[model samples]
Target: MTTLTQLEWRTMADDHRYLIRDMALGDTTISETVLHPDQSTKGHAHPWPEVYLCNAGEGTLYLDHDGGHPLVAGARYVIPGGVHHRVSTVKGVTFTCVFEGPRR
Candidate 1:
């Protein structure tokens, strides 16, 4: 079995305070993000829907129409396809996004 430390991380192009990594699970892609304190995503959208699951820490999820929502460990949020969203961390957050096909 592969450990968490064994996963490969890549620099996120959207921001400097975040790191990302992707793993293929069957036909789906799981993208994990590591966000440092006071950091946030660049806000974007894709053609495929996604599920955001937080593993640790806490943050706020800003949606295109729904405004902002609290994000915490063990919580999950569904993001519809073509809808824009971004995440900001007060401390730090480690989360995984599950989506179909490949990363866009």
Candidate 2:
């Protein structure tokens, strides 16, 4: 893998959603992803475990195994490997995410 000279990058989509950069090397990745109300990642599972910190906003975090629940500010969610999960933003959401495990 090549080294990243810049630690972070930022961009905004045409739809006005913010695209926070993810920076990492080797088997770990970290990023702050902001999603608007009703936004969501299509349900899926990754090879690694992922931790999500809800820094702001409200929503419903859904894990296929853990069931759906209200996501309040300051809450943190952890998902183990092989667990199907996805998050839906109610009134929008911002999360600091960390991922660790064997790289896919």
Candidate 3:
């Protein structure tokens, strides 16, 4: 098993738009991500289900025409496969995401 502390895996993005840390195995992936204010994921979809936990800050999770949810600290969200979605950071956002897929 692998484990990481928040500070242990804190890694900055190329553009410094966010910080991403991975704790994944096989096809299932888990990650912790932090975004600065106004940061977004560029709206995309994966083939697997995604689970998210908002750890801090406020933001909106946008899904095409379905609008968004005002993500508060400690909130949780789940997204099914093939649903185009992206996150918009308000005053900066931090979340952990889990992706379910085949075992490695």
Best by TM-score: 1
Which stretch of 10 consecutive residues in model 1 shows the poorest summed lDDT? Answer: 6-15
Candidate 3 regions exceeding 4 Å error are 1-14, 25-27, 101-104
Q: After superposition, how far is residue 23 of candidate 2 from its true place, in Å?
A: 1.3
Deviation in Å, model 2, residue 10 alpha carbon:
6.3
Ranking by TM-score: 1, 3, 2
lDDT of 1: 0.84
Please, what are the lDDT tens digits per residue for candidate 2 over residues 47-69? 67888888889877788756687
Model 3 scores a TM of: 0.78
Model 1: per-residue Cα lDDT over 49-100, one tens digit each: 9999999999998888466898899989999998899999979999999999
Question: Which wins on TM-score, candidate 1 or candidate 3?
Answer: 1
Write out the backbone clash pairs for model 3: none
In model 1, the Cα lDDT at residue 22 comes to 84
TM-score of candidate 1 to 2 decimals: 0.82
